[model samples]
Target chain A: MKLTINRNYLNDAIQQVSKAVSSRPAMPILGGIKIDVTHQVIVLTASDTDISIQSFIPIEQDQMIVATIHEPGNIILPAKVFVEMIKKLPADQVSIEVEDHFRTTIRSGSTEIQMVGFDPEEFPLLPAIDQNEIIQIPGDLLKTMIRQTIFSASTSEQTPVLTGVLWNLKDNVLKFVSTDRHRLASRTAAITAPDQYQFNHIVIAAKTLSELSRLIPDQNTMIDIVVAENQVLFKVDNILFYTRILDGTYPDTSKIIPQTYETEMVIDTKSLLEAIDRAYLMSREEKTNIVRFMTIDEHTVEISSSSTELGKVTEQQKVQSYKGEPLKIAFNSKYMIDVLKVVDSEQIFIGFSGTMRPIIIKPLDHDYNTYIILPYRTVN
Target chain B: MKLTINRNYLNDAIQQVSKAVSSRPAMPILGGIKIDVTHQVIVLTASDTDISIQSFIPIEQDQMIVATIHEPGNIILPAKVFVEMIKKLPADQVSIEVEDHFRTTIRSGSTEIQMVGFDPEEFPLLPAIDQNEIIQIPGDLLKTMIRQTIFSASTSEQTPVLTGVLWNLKDNVLKFVSTDRHRLASRTAAITAPDQYQFNHIVIAAKTLSELSRLIPDQNTMIDIVVAENQVLFKVDNILFYTRILDGTYPDTSKIIPQTYETEMVIDTKSLLEAIDRAYLMSREEKTNIVRFMTIDEHTVEISSSSTELGKVTEQQKVQSYKGEPLKIAFNSKYMIDVLKVVDSEQIFIGFSGTMRPIIIKPLDHDYNTYIILPYRTVN
Candidate 1:
């Protein structure tokens, strides 16, 4: 097989697919990227068993000859090294030739790289899918939802389901929720899908979801997500991302969310974020990383943290308003800071019932960005 | 002890001296920075046994009251955390009050930090030298000299002297030489020194030398480097960096560098560096990372590398001239690439005597940088 392609075009396609390539694959052949040169187009595929990314480069890109194929063939080349070599090649056009013994030669200008390749037949085939059962959402919206909730997913594999984000759809709306047991983040958005697009529970690994987000460029492009029995496929313009679905059921986290509040205060988001950040830096030397908060007046709130080894820090910030009784409470400063970063609001309202009760943080204008953090006990 | 200093001024001084503070210090007291508040100035000092850095902030910074002396006193605050706290403080001027029990109160704006301070009397005092053997050079030039030769020093402590750079001074020139036995780098620059300031051999640890460079700002100001019998003091503006000198004599690397070459080749420094970089990336899978070069003709050079596991890469470049005779040589691409990166020249002339001999890469003109690398044997 022989083909010539524009170096920049091939580099872009290879980079998109290489995101799914695993440096240490369970199967040796899985470490390579499968390249298929057909009469119409050149396709690149890379997979790490859990997630597969595929991109197709058309014969013509912007009135330029991106690829000219002499024969229809396929070969699997080492994904990581070949991609790096092609990126460093000096010429504008690159030619690739595959011999009968699975030897691949990539040449551009005066630089030529001859690498050992594996037979494309040995690489795993893309799983078959019924494209009818799919949910459609804008790429940027999906990426935003993933970014907000994915960080809360448990990184450890001890509880497999918690390592994935629970995606549930109901009444033409898609909801994404993630939690590591200490805190939870959920985002919901409307989608133009049938009300009966029957899906009860689907947990996709947080890492796979994040990789899918990275593959999609930030645009108003739409992606079709299809969840089969045990695998999921995302179809974009000339690209496809497939990931395996988690097997276990996710826990019910609805009850832990606060339904009522005894006291509420509205504070500037940036000021509170900065105050908590300073408190967090000081609390790092303490055992619990605890920071205390109290309503000093109707328009002022105080934040403080103490460490026997490092020191103690206390600061005050002015807020828009405060209600109910004045009180002092302690919570993990890092957790509060994390929630504030993702909850993008100019002024945020925080509700507290007591010292050990969960604190609810939400935008005062009733937007969908709401977060709750369980407070640590302060024995005062 | 009481002091109110401008936060920016204190932060800058702390950042410079904190480089010498090591958390896992050989001496426990070295973990904290010594703070001495006198009538007129506030002094901050940090030491890690091998190196000591001290900086003073006077009372005249923006008419800010730096120190009131309240009874001149001293204490040591944990270096790493204290610096971080001061950086995050809110107020422009910070007031620090130390009680008799060593409880330190640092107040800035509404933020208050109470930290435990250790007795500053336990801190190690740097060796004081009375003999004034000093050489003066531009701080920027001294920083550049340190950056150029310090990377070649031996990292292993097996032969302690090899881990230090040998400084030789005579005839108004200060020469710095460092070698790990495999390769050597030496730089010579003119300096202003008194006639009595003569040193045949003085070794300073490469780690200490590099840290001292960071303390020198981008001002074209001159710094006095006083080299004593057992200590080296770098006095730049208000900053003083003192380092314990390595005692043993360094090896004589002058005889190993070849003065003449049988074959010489002149090539564009940027092109040669880029080609070597490409060859290095391909040779990552090989055992020795060896890249071979052959003088093909009067104006052509061929570069190639092959690994049984990853296959082969070959590149060729056209040059201005190849003198003497046709030659073939192989060397560790990583080492040569590093040396090429630091050599600043548009055109570089490489000189070689034999395949097994060390190659010297110098600028087409002696006014530019020079580098030398040892060749590795290629397997037949």
Candidate 2:
């Protein structure tokens, strides 16, 4: 294949696909990115066993020339070294040519590299999926939903399905849920899709979903998502991300969420996050990174943590309001801090049923973001 | 000890001394910083078995009141935790009170921390040294000299003295030398010291010397260096750093640096460094990360590296002149890049004795910077 392309566009496409290229691949060919130069477009593909990414650069983008194929062919080059060489090449545009014998020549300015390329036939074929059962959603909204709940997914591989995030769709609202048995994070977003398009439940590996979010740049446009029996594909801009769906069904986490609360308090999000961060650092040398919050009066709240071996830290954050009986509870500072960072509200309302109950934290004025954390028992 | 100290000043002092606090300290008390509060100054001291740092924050610094002591006493607080807490304190001035029994209470604004403090008498004291044999040099020049030669020091502790940089002073010239057997780097600087401050040779651990350089702020002031029989002390500004000097005679590296060359070429320092850096990234996957350079013509040079498994890269750099006979040699790209980064001159001249001998690199102007790299044999 022979083609000339803009350095920036080619770099972006290569970077997006390179994320899926593992350092040590089960199949040696998986470490290389397959480059196909067609008459119309140049497609770049990279995959490990878990996920595969393919990005296409069309011939025309915003009136600028994307690529011109002098000869149509294909070649597979080492992803890492090739990308690094191209990035450091001292030229505005790069020309890539593949000989009939599979020798690839990359030239930019006076710098030229001749590398023995692998036959495209050796590269794995793209997974075939019917797009009939597809739904369209705003890229930004999908990215946000993934960020808000993906962190709660279990990283352990014993229950493979738990390592994935569950996506449930009804009407026009999309809910994302993730749980690691100890804690749960759920977020929902309003998406525009056809009335006929519906999905009961789909589980995609949390890592793959997070990688897909990074692939989608900040664009307000909508991307099409298609789910085949055991595969899910997200067509984000010029990139297509495909991941194999988990086989087992996800556990039901609805009952674990609290339905009511005995006490609720509204506190500034930034203040509480900072206090939790400080307490987290203080607990590193202790058995448990524990931080406790106590409501003394109507407007006074005290956050304190202590380690017999590493001393104690007490931080106070003022809250706007607190109701019901005064309560004191201790929980992992890291968990509460991670959830607080994703909540999109200036003030957060924290609910407490009792000292040992799993506390629920949600936005004071919104219902889209919800996080629950199990509290640690304080030894008196 | 009872005192109220400025938070920023306390943070800076804690940060400077915290480097000496090792996570796996040899002794329990060695992990803490001894805080001695006198009527005039608050001295913070932290020490490991190898190096010790003591910084004094006086009652007043540059017209700004730093610390006010109500009761003069001493206590050793955990360096790591204490530093973190001081950085996060909320108030401008923090009140630190030590009870008669030695419990330390640190309060800033509404935040308070009660940490277990050890008796100051248990802290290890730095060895006392007479100031009769002292050498004064520009702080900035000393920092530059350390950066230029420390990289060539042997990192492996098999030969303990090789891990240190040899400091030899005679007359008004101070020389710094470090060698890892394969390559050697030596630099010299001119300074004025007392007639009695004549030193033949002293070796300080490169790691300790580098850390001491960081303590010297950006200033053109003079720094007093006192070399004891088994310790070296650097007194700069209000900070005093004492490190145990390495015993045993340093290997002679002066003979390894050749006096003449077969081929000499002058090239732009930035261009040469960038080309070497990019070439290094490509060759790093191989065994020695070797990059070869050959003078094609009087004004042109070619740099190339090829890995049998990975691809090859060739870059051309324009040089001002190529003296002596045309030559080609290969050396470790990483070492060349590291040495090139320290060159302050715009144009650097490289002198080669032969293809097998070590290649010497110095500024075109020959103003005190020199780097020698041993060549690796190329397999046919």
Candidate 3:
């Protein structure tokens, strides 16, 4: 196998696939990236069992030749070393040639590096999946949807299905919901498709979506998402991202979200976020991370937290509007902080049902984002 | 104690002293910074066992009132927490009041934090040191000298004296030397002081100097360095930096440095550095990090390294000049890389004594810097 490719093009492509490669893969061959070069394009692929990334660089792009392949073949090179080598190469063009012993030679400028590689046959091939049902969504919006919900997923392995963000696509709107059983975050966006094509309970791992988001360029270009029985594929430009679909029935979370609220208050997002942030520093030492919020008057709210060892912090700020009985509730400050991060509006409406009930936060001007946080019982 | 100071001014002062504070200090009170307030100044002091830093923020400077003190007293606040709190304060000016029971109230805007702090009396007092034998050096140059030689010091605690950089001053020349018994780095600079204030073998811990280098502002102002029996102090602006001198005499490393050499080659420092850097990656996998250099011809030098598992990297670079017998030698690439980083000339002179003897590297046109690296023995 012999090929000469543009340094920047190869570097970027290798980096994209390398994220799917694991350093401590179960099989040694799984730690390598498969490189396949044909008459038209050079394909770089990496798989770490849960997810696989394949990126292709065409021989000629935009009337300019990016790669010239003298011979078409394939080789499996160690992902970590190959990426570093290509990045540090001296010239703008790099040539790679593989010999019978699976020995690879990489040359650029006056520097030549020869390294041992694994056989491509030992590596896993891309899994075959039925891609009849396809949905197109804007890349920028998809990335935002992933970011807004992924962080709410459970990191623990005890509940396997809770580690993924649930996707429900129906009526041309794609809704994402992620809950770690402690807190839940949901976001919805309207797409160009119609209700004729609908898919539900398609769970994708939070980590998988995080990697896919990074691969997609930040633009308004359309990205094709193909669904299968147990595998889902996201296509961004010439790159294909395949991930395993989680197996389980998602719990019905709507039963827990209160249909009616006992109190509602509108406050500046920035002011409340900052106030809770300061209070969090002290509560962090108490091990509970509980910060208390009390409504003092029609236009007043108090954010405070105290620890027997770390002392106390109290911050009072006037809200834009408040319509609720004067009360104080304690909850995890981190949940509030995370929910406030994705608030698209300057003012956010916060509704509380009871001291022990889950509090809801919604964007004041739009119905696109909503967050629910469970409060902790505190003895006043 | 009561004072209202500019937030930024107090924040910057606390950060500088916080460097000397340790997270795992032997004494609990040592984890706090002593705050001393007077009619004219507010001093922040922090000290770990190895180093102590004191910074004074004057109430008035440059015809501007920076702080207004209503009362004068002292208190100790936890270094880490206080610094974070001051940084997050909402108001431009922050008022700090220390009352009975060591309860400190820090108020800024509508936010107030009350925390229990240790009594200032529990903190250790600064050690008394002789201030008569003082040597003056420019702050910027002192920082440069430390950066050039500190990395050469041994990081292992087995060799206590080798972990300290040796300072020898005579005839208005300040020379710093550090070695780990395998390699030695020395730098010399002439200062604006007379020979009457000469001192020799004043050893300071490399870690202490590293922290001190960060405290000194990047300016050309003169800094007074005071030498005592077992301590050294540096005064930069209004900050007083003190470090305990290491015990035991530094080894005589000058004997290992060769006065003359068998072969001398002058090469571009950057080219040789980069070549070795690439080769080092392969040699690093072999466990020795040994990169070999051979004089191929009158003006050519070959740099190469190989591992049976990771393959090899070879680079051929042209030199400015070469003399004497053509030879091949091996040395630790990491040491070469570190020494090359501090070379002051574009063209550096590399001299070899033998295959196993120590090599010397210095600036081609000047004798301001010298580095000696012991070569590795290779079976050819």
Candidate 4:
């Protein structure tokens, strides 16, 4: 393969694909990034058995020639070194030529790097998924959904299903739910999809979702997602991301969310976040990370945390509105903080059904997001 | 202690002194920051046995009241927690009150924190240094000198003195030298000091110098440096930094630098640095980090590195001037990159005695800086 391509474009593509390259691949060939040079486009692929990422660079883009191909071929190069070398290449235009025995020479400006490549046939083929039904979602909405719920996924592998976020699609509404037994986060978005193109129990690993989130554009571009029996594919612009669906069934969490509240309050998100943050500092020293929330009055609430060795922190803020009987609850401040950070609303609604029940938090102005945290049973 | 202080000022002072606070102190008290409050000023100090830093916040600065004292007292608070708490405090003005038994209450806005403070009397006292003669230097210059030589200091404790940078003050000139016996870096600056007040054999740990460097202001402000028999005190504005001198004799490195050269070349510092940086990436894979430099002709030079598994990287650049015989030498590219990063000049002069002799590098327009790197004995 011989071609001169725009260095910036090539570097950008390599970076996108490098995210799927594992530091410790199960096989030596799996560590290589497969490069396929065709007359129309150059495709770069990297995989670590769990997920595969492919990025394509076309011959010409926006009237400007991106690559001038003299020969068409394919080769697999070591991902780590190739990624670094491509980023640091000296010139705007870089020429890559693969000779006999897969010896590749990369030249840019006055610098030339010769690297040994592996045969493309040795690399594992990406799993093929039949795209009979495709679901379309805004890129920014997908990114937001992943960021909002991925953190709630259990990092422990004891229950493999809990490590993945469950994607539920029905009636043109896409819902993402993740829970770690102690807490749960759910986000829903309205998308344009055929009524028959609905799927449930489509769980994807939180790690793979996070990587896909990074690849998604920040703008309101549309992303095409295709789900098969055990494999899922996401096409973001010219990049194709594929990951295997996690095995096992996700536990049903609808029963945990309370339908009624004994007390509810509307509070400023930033103010409550800051108060809980300060209380968190003290609770962190105790390792329990328990912070107490108590209603001081109809318009005021107090947040406090204490450590035997470091002392106590207490703060009170005025809430917009409060109803029903006064209440007190204790919860892990870290979980609250995580939920608050992803909240994009100015005000939040918090509901409590006495002290022992799960505390529900939702955006005050919308019904599309919900978070539930189990309160810690503290001896008062 | 009872006082209402500006949170920003107190936070800055705490951050400055916290640099000396060790994560794992030999004694638990060493992990705390000592705070002394008087009618005139509030003093914050932190020590890790080897280094002690004290910062003073006066009652008023620039005609603005920094603190209002209601009572005078002292206490020691855990540095890590205190630092983090101060940063997240809720208000601009914070009130700190020490009740009976050293129980401190910090109030800001609607938030209140009660911390269990340790008795200041239990904290270790800083070593007293007698200052008969004082030397003055620009803070920026001292920072630059430390940055230029500290990277070359030996990190191993086998030779304790090599872990410290030797400071020789003579003839109103302060010279700093550091080496790991493989490479050496020296920087000198003219200072305002008494002609009779010359001192030598003063060695300070690289770690201490690094901390002191951070405390120094970037502006060209005058700094008072006092050398004691066993300690050195640097008074930068309202902050006093004291460090114990390392106990050992430094080896003489003057003999290692070549006096005359068999070949000399003047080159653009940035171009040579970039070429060597790229070559270093390939050499790093081989673990030896050896990059070969050879004279291509009167005005051109080649830099290259190779790995048995990764192949080779080669780059050629043009030099401004070249004299004497053409030669080839191999040296540690990492060390060369380190020196190039600290160089402030655009053009550099390189002098090589032969393929095996030590290579000398100096700024083309100044004589205050010098670096010597020994070439590797590679089998061609």
Top DockQ model: 4
Among the numbered candidates, top TM-score falls to: 4
Sort by DockQ, top down from the best: 4, 3, 1, 2
lDDT of each: 0.84, 0.85, 0.88, 0.92
Q: Chain B TM-score in candidate 3, rounded to 2 decimals?
A: 0.98
Chain A of candidate 2 scores what in TM-score?
0.95
**lDDT of each residue in A1-380, candidate 2, tens digit only:** 78999888899889989998978977768889999888888899998867889999898888888777788888889876887887777778999988867778888775777777777898877789998767788888888889899889999999888899998888878888998887899998877666756686689889888888888779696889888888888898888988888878899888877777888888999888877777777786685888888887888788888778767888878888888888888898888988988888999989899999889999989899889898899874
Residue B207 error, candidate 1, Å: 2.4
- Deviating ranges (above 4 Å) for candidate 1: A378-380, B61-72, B367-369
Candidate 4 docking class: high
Task: Give the candidates in order of lDDT, highest first.
Answer: 4, 3, 2, 1
In model 3 chain B, the worst 10-residue window by lDDT is: B191-200
The worst-scoring run of ten residues by lDDT in candidate 2 chain A lies at A192-201
- Which pairs clash in the backbone of model 2? none
- Estimate TM-scores for all models: 0.95, 0.95, 0.97, 0.98
lDDT winner: 4
Q: Where's the lowest-lDDT run of ten residues in candidate 1 chain A? A: A363-372
On residues B1-380, what C-alpha lDDT tens digit does candidate 1 reach at each position?
88777888899999988998987977656889998888878889999888888999897756656544555678899875688888988778888889977889988887888888888878987888764567899999898788778888999999999999888888888888888877777778888999856686789999888888878889797999887778888898999888998978788777777888989988987777778778887787775878999888888898888877778888897887778978889988877777777776677888998988888877686642456678878765
Task: Please give the clash total of every predicted structure, in order.
Answer: 0, 0, 0, 0
